[model samples]
Target chain A: MNALGNAFSLLAGGERETWWTIATSLRFSLWSTVFAVIPGVPLGAALFLGRFKGKRVAVAMVNAIMAVPTVVVGLFVYSFISRSGPLGSLNMLYAPAGVIAGQALLAFPLVTAMSYTGLQKLDPRYNETLLTLGARPWRRMIAIIREGRFVIVQAVLAGFGRVTGEVGVSMMLGGNIRWYTRTMTTTIALDAGKGEFERALSLGIVLLGVALSINFLSHLAVRDAR
Target chain B: MHADAVRNDAVRNDAVRNDAVRNAPAFSVSRLTFRYERKVAVSCDSLEIHRGETVAFTGSNGSGKTTMLKLLNGLLGPYDGRIDFLGLPLARNPLLRDRSVFVHQHPVLFSGTVKDNFEYALRLKRVRGAEAAKRIAMTVERFSIGPLLEREAGRLSGGETQRVAVARAVAAGADVILLDEPTSSMDSASGSAIRAFLLELRRSGTTLVFSTHDASLVLDLAGRSVRFESGRVVDEPSTGGTL
Candidate 1:
């Protein structure tokens, strides 16, 4: 009850800060999705279509990645971007870019695994038809992707949902600095820890809204893909 | 890739031939064999099909007719023997598949509208604008699928999807259409419609090689029928041994 009351209070007095946090959250999630899905889709399709050796092992690796903890991802990326690490020369530590990199790694496995199952289940008859019709290699690939778009789209939206609400990656990699990399989830965590219930509850509401929206869209896409 | 064989790149006979017997056979094979996961699916020796011939491969389940059809269309390959398309070996005729389309037992209508499925091949072959439109229109009307053009292909009834699949193959203008049980699961109305469509295709000079367990369809449609059992075409020919 107190959290609900605090949320309304924050809504009245903290509109600008709330909007900024939401914007940062959206930006972080969107960029992470882009980075993850660009490579995830082709890799997923190739894993499904290619019949060479050790494909099962590759697929198993992706499945294993999906089970990894988000905090572990945060730590791995944090270590890489730290001043003493190999990539430290870039000075990305505690920056929004570091947050994006960590979150992208967190999302990659989900997208690949989902898309692989999607393309794997696709009827092989379509490929044969395309070949017999003399579709050029590029055209065939594009057509297959388009036909398989629903699975990829669902994977992307699911990844976006996960990344949007994840506090560990942003808290560790972005340092959750106010007026800079402070995203909805990270701010909510920090505010709650400091007993600032209104700001925390308000941020929680915004993050929940984003997560619900992504879930709704994913539901529609899965149904439509059928 | 044969080391000790003469390459018959000339895909025509040297002598003049009568209209009844074409100079080039549609498919000529010697020792054609295929295996799937340690089980021999097809093992045929010395088989030839002529142009415009309607050949039915009748067999029980798991008898390898479908596998043989796939091999003929270049979908499965690297078999035990040579397959010549119109007197030229597969190695010399890379465009062989462009001339032969295979329709599966349960044709998969991909995710799109029926019109999209019908136009997929034409667009692939780069048939553009008015020509593509005209062909699509002609095919839709000819196949009696005009009402279904706007329906989602993936949402269609099984029989409706099969009709569209057959029409798509026809619209693509493939020389040889290999169908595996095209009418097996269809309702009587749909079955009769497919039967009529196949007859029309035959009249249009499109060669058809289909597998079926339906003896009546073979009796009504095929000029030649070959029985298959245990992965080999039995010597009993329904018509003359050679057409």
Candidate 2:
């Protein structure tokens, strides 16, 4: 109980390091979500709109990837960016870029799977109407994306939540370098490991708040869509 | 005298070709079979629709009338046989979409104002500027839909949505319109409005194909009737239609 009180005071007292850690976590998560969405949404749209053999298998693969452990994703990216690996010369490891890249990779399958599943719920008549009106392939996709924007927004929020709360990617790729690469989750892990419970509990509280806020926004998106 | 005889023969041949073109069927189907997840939905052996003809497909629920309409519009495919539009094979005729449009039963009006829906349809056909404005004006006047123009399409009532959908199609310059149960579940007022609009379309010499359970619609509008039973076309007969 005393540790919880101290955690709240630390948050209320506006400690500089704690706030910076929160900001770094948010910034990295936002950038990762943007990177993931750039390619992920279109891939999801293709998976949903395309008609071909092996499409079912492709969808199944994306779903399976979404369930993969964050540590596994971190390891995969680390292998690529580590020295002597394929992309080692870029020097992304132990840097903010590496953390963002790792988080984006971790969120990519989630965004793709969620977006595809969301688009599946769109009205069949919308596509038929677009087809009958002679919309070309590109125009049809844009229209479909616009029509399902609400569901897509939910998928994006889900991706943001995923990267924001994950510890493994940040710990492995960002290297938990103090004053530079340290994020809320990595800081919490480090502080908790050193028997310092107050800051860790505070960051946990913040993470919970972020999760609830994302869920609320998702609900609002659905309501507006209706 | 010899030259005049040759000229007259040439004119006669040209006239014959023109008549044949004018009389060509809008759609011709042969041995069409469409299946849904292993169960046959439509298996039509032969069907034809003439230019400027209003044809009604009458059938019980799940009897494949809607599927036939979709096939005719080229919305579904991989069927076993062939469909020809205006004497050319359907597969080779990409311009068929420019000349034909399909309307669903509930009529999906895109998420915007009714005027926006009209603009979208016209834009699909590459109609713009003065010509698009002219078409919108003409359609609004003809349908008496001026009041509904600025209203959000999603908020429109059932009858209004159907009216806007058909009017929007007309504005897009569709020569042939296929509709699926346009008035199946409408109230009397809405149903009457749709029937009246359909009558107007027929009188304008547009080729119309529709599926309906309404007997009076068939009696009043159809130039011919096709009946469907268990995914097969049972009969197609001219009923002295179009009163």
Candidate 3:
């Protein structure tokens, strides 16, 4: 009970920092979702709607990537951006950009795979109906995408939630530098590891709040989809 | 039969026969074949649908009625032979896309409000603002879908959804409306409404080709019937079921 009281007091006292942390996490998530969705949606749409040889292989690979370990993604990206690595000259390491990159990679396959599932579940007759209406290919694509908007929205929310609360990528790639590269997850990790239990618990509570909000939104989107 | 009824029937039959010959066929399929993998869905068939005429294609399940409709709109390319729509060969010229439209058996409704679903086809064609609104209103009134315009499409009943689907297709300015079981899932009231709409469409010179399993419905609407069996058209009217 004392611990919970201390945690709440710490959160109340550190409201500014808490809000900053939340704002930064949101910024990162928004950019990551934008980066992920741009290519992810079209790729998923093509893989599910287009008919060509080896399409199955592409879909299989994306589905496999959905389960990719976040730590593994961090490690893999770390190798390429580290001081001695190929992209080392960019010096993106230990920055929010690097964290975004890692999160984008982690989120992309998830968004794509879920979007693909949504598109595949659509009735093929929709495509045919559009084509018959003299809709151009681009037009047909838009119509189908618009029809599947609810599913796409849910996929994006899920992807955002996955990245916002993820620790492995931010911890490894951002180096957890306070007020520089530190996100909520990384802050919580650093505070907990250093025995700043109140701060850590505060961050943890905030992260939980974020997760719950995202889950609520996703649930609403799915209900709207039906 | 009553004298007035006999006269009306004779005049209707004559008008149908004359129209069949006078109006150039909106769709002409010659020696067409379509296959999925190694199995044939439709084989070496010839058909022509005249402009402003309502033609019905009837057959048992898997008789290729749906496949034939798909061919008219370039939804499926033919494996052999040719399909000409509005004097353009669908294979050689892609412009048939500009003038033809198709409606599916199971209507596709988007996840937005009813107005959004109705406007989707027009928006694709780049119609917007007041012009788009006018056409939408016209269609909504025509289909009596005014109450449904603000409702989410996903929440509509099957019959209401089908009405919106048909309205959207028609509003897209389809020179040819191909309905695949448009009324298959509707209640009697909705079915009657749709039938009335199709009749009005016919009078307005829109060419309609539809497939149905309902014999009586076909008899009431179609001027001619084309029957298929085992992937081929059985030519004799004796074998071909009457509309």
- Highest-TM-score candidate: 2
- Cα lDDT of all candidates, in order? 0.81, 0.89, 0.79
- Candidate 2 on A1-226: residue-level lDDT in tens? 9999999999999999999999999999999999999888888887888889999999999999999999999999999999778999999999999999999998999999988999999898888898888887777888888889998999899999999999999999999998889999999999999999999999999999999999999999999988
Ranking by DockQ: 2, 1, 3
Error of 2 at B156 (Å): 0.5
**What DockQ was computed for model 3?**
0.45
Higher-scoring candidate on lDDT, 1 or 2: 2
Each candidate's TM vs. the true structure?
Answer: 0.84, 0.93, 0.80
Best by DockQ: 2
The candidates' DockQ values read: 0.58, 0.62, 0.45
For model 1, residues A29-140, the per-residue Cα lDDT tens digits are 8999899998887778777766688989999999999899888999999889998998999988888889999999999988888888878777687778777667766777
Question: In CAPRI terms, where does candidate 1 land?
Answer: medium
Higher-scoring candidate on lDDT, 2 or 3: 2
Reference-based lDDT, residue A41, model 2: 85
Clashes of 2: 0
